[model samples]
Target: MTSDRARLREENEALRHQVATLRQELTCLEEQMSFLVNLCVASHRLHETADRRELLGILREILNNIVGSEELGIFELDAKRSVLSLVDSMGIDPAGFQSIALGAGVIGHTALTGKTFIAGDGAAPTGTGLEPGLTACIPLRCFGGDVWGVIAIFGMLPQKPALKPQDRELFALLERQAGLVLAMTRPD
Candidate 1:
């Protein structure tokens, strides 16, 4: 009878451990689902927006609330001139680094190659003037395969110390949706 009782207690403890692990997995899934839903809603809103000002506001919200970054800049690309002109920015001053030439720096390289430039991946291009805190440069490419602009993310929020797959997904979404919206809203 004593041995049987000990075995029962051990089995009960194992079952409790399993339950706790399952609860943690469930919580992670729920958070992922919530992020996805918010992203979808933001994408829909971007598609529905017609005004350039309102679109910029929505972009700001996505950068701040969704991607968890406060310092960022959006630069519009002029292919003919091979230049990137700052159109909007937040948590960073846009005075000296307003315009970047193609192949000039990190932002310029991303603008030219249409590939992301992660800060920690390597040293930033010479003379890019990327702030010490800058972490990533995401090129905004339109659906037509043209690089429309670049979004320079300075740093992640303290709570988000490292970049995740979902963060990259959000960058891709911005590359497509924001590019299309900016192209549509550009004044001829």
Candidate 2:
């Protein structure tokens, strides 16, 4: 009887451990599913319209709702590729970022190299129209490996102090999809 009781206790403990592990895995999966839903919604919204103004409005909503950024600027690369001009913005003064020359600062560098630059990594915004505290610069790249625009996030919303790993993933999605959508939606 003693041996049987010990065996039962060990089996009970093992079952409890298995249950706890399953719970942890379930939580992680739920988080992943939630993130996936966000991605799906963002992608759907990006391709939802062909109107320029409406597209920009949807982009603003994505920035505000999904990206957790209250302040952001969307810059379009000039046909000559020499300048990035602020085409649209939200939650901040656009006077400082009226235009940026290619390779001049973080925003320009992002446009020049197609690299995303997140703040707090020894990089700062400099040059003309880039004085506002920027949180990140995401290059909008097209299929041919050309960067045609940049999405600059300035001081993420007050609730979000910093970007998360998932935020980077979402940014990557935007980099891949936003440009193509814009190109398709542009008027001839």
TM-score per prediction, in order, is 0.93, 0.85
Give the alpha carbon lDDT tens digit for every residue of 44-111 in model 2.
99888888888888888988887788899998888585999887899878887888888888888889
> 67-98, model 1: which lDDT tens digit per residue?
78888998899989989999999888889578
Q: If candidate 1 were superposed on the true structure by all CA atoms, what would the RMSD be?
A: 1.6
Each candidate's lDDT (Cα)?
0.84, 0.85
Global CA lDDT computed for model 1? 0.84
| Over 4 Å off, model 1 | 122-124
lDDT of 1 at 101: 85
Q: Which residue segments of model 2 deviate by more than 4 Å?
A: 1-10, 120-132
- Steric clash pairs (candidate 1): none
TM-score of predicted structure 1: 0.93
